[model samples]
Target: MTSDRMTPEVLWSMGRIGTFNVSPDGNTAVYTVTYYSVEQNKSHSVIYVLNLNSKAQTLLTTSPKSEYSPVFIKNGQKIAYLTAESGTSQLWEMNVDGTDKRQISFEKDDISEFLFSPDEKLLILIKEVETDASIAKNDSDLPKASGMVINNLMYKHWDTYVKSIPHPFVARFNGDRIEDSTDILEGEPYECPMMPFGGIEQLSWSPDSKSIAYTCRKKTGKAYAISTDSDIFLYDIATKSVKNLCKQADWTEQPCDTTMSLEHQAVNHQQKDNNVGYDQNPAFSPDGQRIAWLSMERDGYESDRTRLCVYEFATGNKTYVTEKFESGVDQFLWMPNSKNLCFSGVWHGKTQIYTTNLKGDVKPLTDEVADFSLVSLAPNGKDIFCKKHSMKQADEVYLLKGNKLEQITFENKHIYDRLTMGNVEERWVATTDGKKELCWVIYPPHFDATKKYPALLFCEGGPQSPVSQFWSYRWNFQIMAANDYIIIAPNRRGLPGFGMEWLEQISGDYSGQCMQDYLSAIDDLKKEPYVDEEHLGAVGASFGGYSVYWLAGNHDKRFKAFIAHDGIYNTQQQYVETEEMWFPNWDLKSAPWIKNAEGQMQKAFRESPHLYVDKWDTPILCIHGQRDFRIEYTQAESAFSAARLRGIPAQLLLFPDENHWVLKPQNGILWQRTFFRWLDRWLKPDNK
Candidate 1:
């Protein structure tokens, strides 16, 4: 806490702000902030209710256990949230003043998430349901058996095996408690909210509260693994019937369906089009006339552009509202008038707010160089409330009134005021393909031009994710600068924010122009006298990790050190080892065993980092988590093995109790420490 510069402990000490919900009358807002306890190796979340008018924030929960996902209920008189105070997760309600806390749902199962209907008569509860029958625990003779029978391809997902999946259940709220709950998915072996990342956002209620719209991919096992084909379903409460809203044009070719009715029900016409990819997060209009959700065009491509699609309830016509935006919409809010929708999207290295009408006419609301997430609108509907953050700062609530963005909740202001953050500058570097790509440059706190400093080339992950003004707990640019290393993050090929052409360029050509762009950005910066060209390093996670591995062999001694976390060392092994088959099938263009006439697959597999280990001479550090199914730990293990076998200086950091991301407080600290220790050993030789 006494450090003037950013450090691992300092970064972990800062409170992280999460999702918030505005009260009914828009007078109060309840949000959650999570704090990590490194000593305890855990974290806790606390909820707070803020008066939007007075800007007075009050802590609503004082329990030792974490309380989060707060929403205003009973006409803003009570705040409802989920907590584990009773050793099991359940719904708890309290007054706006944080008194009279009482448990509502006493179900035997834990409620992962919950959403109340607009009329407050019905409640949607999300809980895990064990559908797989092959588990050893279910056998009468195998009471102590811990093995799982896997007969299908999606047996394991992001971190855990496919034993239980989340399903949405509809229950009646009779004021005091939830009752008469029934699983909307009944006996289906599918995930309603999906897996890994989906939550309550995938479920919504209509204005009348008689129907529930939920997102579900009704496929199981291999079919689920190789497709991104999720659909929106409308479930009627009275008849207990479900209808597929985003049905395929060819019903016979449909991978899955949730229709429970035998006869054709005269309702809103089904969206029978070739709209295949991911169609989820259905949001109903205030007037109950339309529903909007983010949609992707391709079926297997996960990084496809997420267009905002609206379905008119009256006409049964679906319209792509923000097709011309050229990028994906991250989050959106329906205007009070219901004629327009405001959304947040990345464009030119910034995630800004934009307003679009039903006619596809878009207007920029805020063009600042920081990332903004759409929260809600004011009572008057003209002003917008959003969470804004940048590379130099964490998340803080902001009110966008007309054109001005005023900071409302300074959740991390105390930490920010005490720390000296590095300055983040935006630069445009010319790429090897003759394109000007956006790159972010971070300088040390109180930077001096007379001093030469080591530098790091930050390769972005997601492969398609933008190198925007994002604030992160790990891979933080400001923290790297605080360590006395200038950081260059380039929005290279395959990253969004630059049109589809640039974003799609790195799909099959992983070791192509994108790697050159990383070199381009760092090469352009090394020309500066203040930058120590002799002490350059490259680092990344996921696909960015893949970039570092590829660059280790192709960097031509331009980099002194390399660090790859959960990256692919062998493309052939990754093609079958990854849980999501669609990712590899689409990005790598084909299975490794198949003969791709275009030679794309051959090129992709041939360029695997394990194959080029002979050229690796720089000191490299490899890290991975055993639970990470997306990119298995074997990838990192093989990379480290090959590096050492080639007589290169190498180190391996493995985390057994972690997933694709190092989530635990203590594990995260270890990651940062090992990260710096490796970099300092090679890149910071002068300082050592």
Candidate 2:
């Protein structure tokens, strides 16, 4: 291996730029840059303002507390960002040249997210408040509860217990200080912006700044267990009134009754089995006369197609603008004219920008290749800026002009100039069932066609998510290629961007057709003379991890080694322990205890990787995080136990502070080192 190649240290040292906000004049842009310190094992972010006219950038905030979410306010003279310099994340104001920094909010609770009103006189902030304030009251004489009391279905979320829920608050900002604050959803049990990954996108202010629209769940209790019903609510700031825009007649506001009778037959059974939908990401048009948001058609199905919808303020009418659009919409914004919208969505394994009108007319603005996101449109809607990245390059700001993309930022140019990255090529392979799948291969740097190299097949997690041209921090193909290894990533049958039918094929059959597709991909790769057939390895995370586990038992002879990260070994137990019940319920088609044909206790059990553990013979490496509530830590324990019991060579890597993904700077370095070492032990023994 060469010392001048791209390594984990070099990758971590590169700055990560995100959240762009163009000034009103379009002469400048403000964005956040996050830099990590591997030695300190911490990250610090600061805001930077780039002068489009001079092509010069200036640091806007030098706060050590980590500033982010930079936005131009006060007619582009001053900038506002969030910082924890005051012990909690609060709104802070500073000059455009990184001067006159002042704290604006003095709240006891930490602000999750905030947005300035169009008029700049009010600040709408989202804060998480305890359900019972008394529980959080610090009584020095009183002892804290040793154990958590569970009483609700949502007692826990992704990685934490649900002790408090996020709510919105309206504050009157007088440029220097907050005059007063009012809780918008004070008495409601709903959480604005929903949970998990929701952010500022869920809240929107009207053009006049008189009303605000946000998304929240209307159903509680067991309804939440199998329901994905989230509705947009309009709150009038003047009258302090709220209305559920998506609520239907006869909708009861009462809490669910869970009491059962002695006979277990006379219990409260009035709960309706309704298949409502999810509506979120509300954005008001420039004219403020209409509101646009993304909506899902069916309830309880998270993978349902997302359609763009618009609501007219004057007519009180709603319309679906993307009903005919085949792909799901990820993020979008209204044009300045308020007649059209620009959005980014996945198409053929790539995310491209597109334009759509209220009449449902959709047109692609970019090609169906290379990953593009974090779109920012100028005030005139003529200039568009987005972050673009590919297999060979990291994300850099690019300006979309006409049909050509102009790179505006070269943050990683210095790092790229000194390193020799692999050559990436896209290929289409035919599966065993005669279906063509998209696969990407990366050849080692300074490669020769006559020489064979060890290959590592990387499976994506989503099972439904496509492994596009996006640059990944975790499963970096460049680093693998730098280690003198060929990397192969296949977009199999169950992945997205290939149409709805193909994506839903893996549902209720995780180990069936998808496994065959993977096997077919590997067989196709072996046909190439540059691939070493004798030293093949497989690696994946999440669903991909599940696939690796399944392959370890059912087809171990094909690969020399395997790596599974946060994978499900026991499908039956996964269904019962996962926090998100709807995913398992929909994927498996029923509860774990439900019986199927031949008196089998759960149809998904047939696809369980644990069932075929007796046939396992391959050496494997298992990686899991204790904070991964989605898959739970027990899955890793069970996998490692099975491998050790079978007397097969296996190793376990556990992260106590990390989540599903290895995010921290130091942890990421450790993860990469461990991963490459495991692969080297079996696949690259000669190098060792």
| Predicted structure with the largest TM-score when compared to the true one | 1
**Per-residue CA lDDT of candidate 1, range 1-688, in tens?**
2278899998999898887888878889999999999999899999998988899999988788999999899999999999996778999999999999999998889999999998888899999998673232358788787877777788888998878989998888989998877899988889989998999999899989889999988888777777787988889999988888786445644333211110122221245565678988999988989999989876777999999999998877889989889999998889988989999999999999999999999999998879999887876778998999999888998999989988889987888888898888989998877889899999999799999999999989997998999999988888888888899999999999899999999887899988889999999999999999999999999998898888988988899999999898888999889988878877887777666566544568868877788788899999999999999999999999888888889999999988889999889999999999899889877667
Q: What lDDT tens digits, residue by residue, belong to model 2 across residues 581-679?
A: 667766776766666576775556776998888889989999999999889878988999999999999999999998889989989999999999999
TM-score against truth, every candidate: 0.96, 0.94
Candidate 2's C-alpha runs over 4 A off are: 132-142, 250-275
**Any runs in candidate 1 off by more than 4 Å, and if so which?**
133-138, 248-250, 254-272, 597-601
Best by lDDT: 1
lDDT of the structure predicted as candidate 2: 0.82
Collision pairs in model 2: none
Clashing pairs in 1: none
Cα lDDT of candidate 1 equals 0.87
Q: What range of 10 consecutive residues in model 2 has the weakest lDDT sum?
A: 259-268
Q: After superposition, how far is residue 638 of candidate 2 from its true place, in Å?
A: 0.8
